[model samples]
Target: MLRHVLEVLDFLDSPTADGPGTIGILERFLGDLDPSTSELRPLLETQRVVGDRGGTDFVTVTVPGRRGRMADGEAPTLGIIGRLGGIGARPEVVGFVSDGDGAAAALAAAASLLRMWRRGDRLEGDVIVSTHVCPDAPTLAHDPVPFMDSPVDVATMNWYEVRPEMDAVISIDTTKGNHLINHRGIALSPPVKQGYILPLPDDLLRIQEIVTGGPAVTFPLTTQDITPYGNGLRHINSILQPATATDAPVVGLAITSAAVVPGSASGASHEVDIALAARLAVEVAKEFGAGTAVLYDAEEFAKVNDLYGSLAHLQTLDGARDESVLDSMEVN
Candidate 1:
């Protein structure tokens, strides 16, 4: 599993390859949750820009939020949103556009849009584009190892903010507020401890092999899989020592269990209920070639509470939003 995952990640991080193909593999690996039945509707949106000869294509998804819920028809309830985007190419187009940062931003916005939908929320305005540029590819970059240093999991929520552009893409009737979920942006580099520089170049590869292989791999990560003190604060602080001084960024990782389900106790729903916290930990760990799996507790929850109101008030929808509306209206 580690090897397979590494193969995909290596391609994604590679300067030579645009990130789309890698994302396709990820979508395939994760499998598709039903649009209507599962909590993963807006999880992976495939886009295609058609031209005369050949066009461009790519896939994108949003980052999980803090303590995310993975129930269907839901988005992350984390208040803020995060996105991950990538560009791909074809044999015809040699150097296609690589809008990794753009892709990430879109994903974030998509998550937010979804969230707004569940709340019956409306966006403040039309969709807007925020620009970002990728850090130039590492010059003397070597094959980096991939591992799950910690076991991270995922959580998700419903309710996203759908912008005008996404509405154009899906051809949905935006006027009616059918799809309200959208993501914001992504935090590119996570703060985490960097492991010792391996003695041999192959050492990194070995780590990648073990982590990508999953539990069967013989590596320290599985045996050491557990959330660190401070929920990873100490580890992040430790790893960032070298990078912090020179403005270098330290990438840390953690893992947990997560799943996407449909519906919740709060009457929220999602097409893709991704467990963001755990997923972020796992992805960051994989970037560093660590080993670990975040375990998650999956259970359905939705309980209604008692409601007390006058019979007349109960009949009018306005009373729900403003209780005074009930007092002002006279019974027929």
Candidate 2:
């Protein structure tokens, strides 16, 4: 298990960290550990301490309440905390206490186990059942560069409750190549609308074309879906919180293009550059390793719309416009 942990850490550092080969290597390494051996626990504890000292977050589970929000009047105590340490006659059994729909309760138990086994923040209410294990996920305690953010179940994990949107939700977007117009909206050019919600090979091909100059090239794209885990969307919302740019004096725009060459035939390609939308498109594909759309104004969208089509064609387009001109735009 120690070697397995070290391998996981190393893979995480690699450019293609979570590739299939890396996963196979990890599985094989973990297989070497004897489940029957009693040495595993102490080694894990030692590693946990070492990781913590080396600036790695160690996983710990704390169930402050079994039912309802902790701040609410009906919060219940988590009955089993030390059982996971294998301290008693029946040490393998980690305790669980949940009060909710049967599914939610079961999910909470799993979440509690995950928290105990992995380093993460406490959830607020009972466990949100939808989140699944993400081995290389970024800890909430330390934000990483290149912004490796993904949605996870957020309910019952206490800190998630700080945001009103973290109550219960599911992560809808799988293709990590997405941009936010603001918080909840995504921009889509016409070509992307065809398969926005429906997964299509053509749609993926479009993303590939823009990414590589010719066609889709085989590369790594981390894919995880916690829809089966409870409160999925809430978890995603927490993970995808907008970056606060204190130094930038830039305006946001929503733009769409239908006849664009080599981009997802269906899916939003959120764009954000007026002067160099095309160049930015290439930069986005190359730098972030994702296809991107250029942001545009209402008039620009309309002009593009007049040239190609109308914004009304897009089903998920959030019609958000920067009504204030560049001069009138104020940054506080």
Candidate 3:
């Protein structure tokens, strides 16, 4: 995983990094797997979409498990989303920025999984990894530090990255632009289902402990953070954006820093930290797909909803009647 992380970082830490270039790197990595295992090769797909600011390349890699849906099996599919504004700020920042850590970690996890599959260490369910590549994304002003704004908006990102086939999602993002989490490695957010932020499951905690070789560290999430973008509210970042677009339970895997670091700041990515997050994601995918890990207690969630009514309204725009208005709203 560390090797893949370093490889991805080296590729993304360039002014020429773009979506097609990223796809090519991943293709070469997965293509190197033994040909005898070609029957289980992961599916790779990429698309280029233009927006007002610019365009980005959305890439998705589907690593089919032995019992995954793609293989006509019933095991659940896990989605690993690399949520980020861009890899490079280009003219503003000449190399890969801290914001690109999410993409690095995610793509690395995908590469490792493919290699594992080829080595006969396949998981029980499928894993879909998705993220976009934009080398020259714009930067946005914020309180503690500047943010790396996407060429496109959160809605467009969700539409391209979040898939219906994902039974659960692990949204990885570089959350270093704030003072909220004063830790250096990675931190996990509470499991979010629909509009409710459920308690973190013990299974995930164990996995974090195993991956980090230390006590589990978690970050806090506010109601505003989980809400959809363009709702006239301050969000911690785009870490939880995937939750607004899907009913499936989603947990944010944040790459953090001891001090606030601007998203567009180059030379801020830590390979060891990114590798740790990637390894955690890979372990979660393994247990979750094997039915050994649970994102949330469905029965407890239902009980809470029964007593307190629905918070699904929080998933929509404030004063908007439904989610249909999402696409119409302009995201800042």
Candidate 4:
């Protein structure tokens, strides 16, 4: 994991012209792992959706599982999204930035998975890795932490990265800026399937323990956290934004630390910690593709739906029409 992490860091720690956004170089790098198992495509025209925002280069890599994405008897495809604004918060900060951990970790997992496949350990289904590249991304001010602002908005990210072919997704992001999760490794969030906040499955907990060789833990989740962005509401971060555009089951993989680290901070990324997060994504992809890891119990989810009615409304940009009424306003 450490080796793969370093490889990815070295790869993405460069300008977009030479890094992950360049489909040719990235395609060549991935082809080295297993040409049969990896495929890359660069989406240069995505800037149109982002209103011609410069420094935005979107790319998606598909690492074939036992079967391809279109095979008749292929297993479910797993989507691993490196959810971040950019790898380097340039012009605002100096040197390579840790805010890019989401993209770095995501690319690392893709490489490792393909490497595993090359070692004759292919997964059951396909694994798709998608993220954008922008070394000089802008910054935004949020409470408790400052974050790397995206060159393109969240909707554009979902448009290019989130796909209907994905049945499950692991959205990884650097969560060191938040105070709620304090640790040195990774933590999982409850399954955000469709629009409902389903309970975290025990199978995932068991897998976490198995992978970390420690106790399983989860980050606290809220309804607002899972809801779509642009609803005039605050969220922890863009970690869960992928769930908005797809009906697939989604989980957030947070790379945490004991200290409240700002996303814009440089030389703050812990190689070991990022490696752990990447490994978690890799392991989940293996389990999920093999049909051995259940993110949530189907029967239980159905029972909750029957008893409580549909919660899919929460997936909308504006949730619960009555909640939008901010009527009782006064100045003291």
User: How well does candidate 4 score on lDDT at residue 104?
Assistant: 79
lDDT, candidates in the order shown: 0.24, 0.23, 0.89, 0.76
| Candidate number of the best lDDT | 3
Top candidate when judged by TM-score against the true structure: 3
Clashes found in each candidate (C-alpha, N, C closer than 3 A): 101, 31, 0, 0
Worst 10 residues of 4 by lDDT: 323-332
lDDT of 1 at 232: 30
Candidate achieving higher lDDT, 2 or 3 = 3
Give one digit per residue, the lDDT tens place, for model 4 in 35-105. Answer: 37433322222221233344466667777666656554468888989999778877778766777888878
Give the runs in model 3 whose Cα sits over 4 Å from its true position. Answer: 32-40, 318-332
**lDDT for 54 (candidate 2):** 18
TM-score for each candidate, following the candidate numbering: 0.24, 0.18, 0.94, 0.87
What's the CA error at residue 170 for candidate 4, in Å? 0.7
Against the correct fold, how does model 2 do in TM-score? 0.18
Question: For candidate 3, which ten residues in a row score worst on lDDT?
Answer: 323-332
lDDT per residue as tens, model 3, 221-304? 999999988878999999999998888999999999999999999988899999999999999999999999998889989999
Per-residue alpha-carbon lDDT of model 2 for 1-332, expressed as tens digits? Answer: 22322333333323232223332432342234447854212111100111111111122222332233443524322211100000011111111101001111122233323333233333323222121122233312211112222222222221211223222111112122223222212122221111111122343345435533453322111111111112222222222111110111111111222222111121222312111222222222222211122211234434554676532322111333222222322211
